[model samples]
Target: MIVNQFLVLGALLFSIGVYGVLVRRNAVLVLLSIELMLAAVNINLVAFGAFVDDAAAAGQVFALFVITVAAAEVGIGLAIVVLIFRNRSSANVDELDLMKW
Candidate 1:
């Protein structure tokens, strides 16, 4: 249960998430990648919190806050994606031009 092991695992997960975000063309896949990245962050936070031996459990608390925010983000993101898909019939990120005038 070495802290380094946890750190390495988090780093690996984050790297994979980044790759997925950069290479994937689907909006849903992008959101999944973002969730993966958030999970990696949570892993690191808990690992550090345990390592620091903080009395207030700040790391876990912050991780909880991140989880809450991530959930909200997924809700909003999926809603937007669904709307776009319904309108455009495709969820490809590169094809989206809703912001263009």
Candidate 2:
């Protein structure tokens, strides 16, 4: 029952993140969507770790790794976005076609 609820919540959040990424043209919004997706993944991991109270803490460890990766991604992504904004005068992804070479 609780596991099902957690799965449902994770699924919903993932779907929302996907939708946001697909519908938004701003790079920042896309980054935010990615963060949402990562959050959903973390929720699933933590929930599973809590549900199965075994001696294995692999799920929790994986969640911590995911968090670390997400933080690094956000940092790098923001830096790139800022650079693009400074050069292009806007943060819209549609304007990034100049780099298609």
Candidate 3:
């Protein structure tokens, strides 16, 4: 497959993710959108790594790191979302004011 194909796919996924993040009101949906964006980035990384023919497989390694960080993000994000829902009974991002003094 051509690298351009992967690039286009990545761009499409990233665009969708961005739209979801911007339009979705639910915190869970926002987190999922963020994950989608990360997946697009991973796709691009692997594609570029293959195109470069790097011996170190740096692209795959970086993709792995991104995955790890994403997992941690999801864990923490969900935890906070759950806590907010428990306290507020709503998961709407617009309704959250925990940071407000």
Candidate 4:
């Protein structure tokens, strides 16, 4: 029962994140939505690892790696967003899609 609830909530969070990414145009907003989706995946991983397997911690380990990567991604992504704003004076992803080489 608890697993099912956790799974449902995770799915809902992921769906919300997808919706936000699709509807929002700001670069920072889209990045935050992506982070939300990643968080939902981590939640499901930890919940299942805790409830189903007490010995193997693969899910938890994966979540940790994901968190680590997400942190790196946020740093680089924010720096890029700031660079874009400095160059274009706008942070909207749609407007900034000039395909930089």
Best by lDDT: 1
For residues 1-101, write the lDDT of model 2, one tens digit per residue. Answer: 37989989999999999999999999999999999999999989988988886687877988999999999999999999999999988999988786675
Residue runs of model 1 more than 4 Å from their true location after superposition: 97-101
Candidate 2: segments with Cα more than 4 A from true spot:
99-101
The 10 consecutive residues of candidate 3 with the worst lDDT sum are: 92-101
What local distance difference test score does each model get? 0.97, 0.93, 0.96, 0.93
- For model 3 the local lDDT of residue 38 reads 100
**lDDT, candidate 3, 1-101, per-residue tens:** 57999999999999999999999999999999999999999999999999998799999999999999999999999999999899999999998765887
Worst 10 residues of 4 by lDDT: 92-101
- Whole-model lDDT, candidate 1? 0.97
Flag clash pairs in model 2.
none
**Candidate 4 ranges beyond 4 A from true positions:** 97-101
What is candidate 2's CA lDDT for residue 96?
Answer: 77
RMSD of 1: 1.7
Each prediction's TM-score versus the true structure: 0.93, 0.91, 0.93, 0.90
Judge candidate 4 at residue 81 and give its lDDT: 97
Lowest summed lDDT across 10 adjacent residues in model 2 is found at 92-101
Total clashes, candidate 3?
0
Q: What TM-score does candidate 1 get on C-alpha atoms?
A: 0.93
- Residue 15's lDDT within candidate 1 is 98
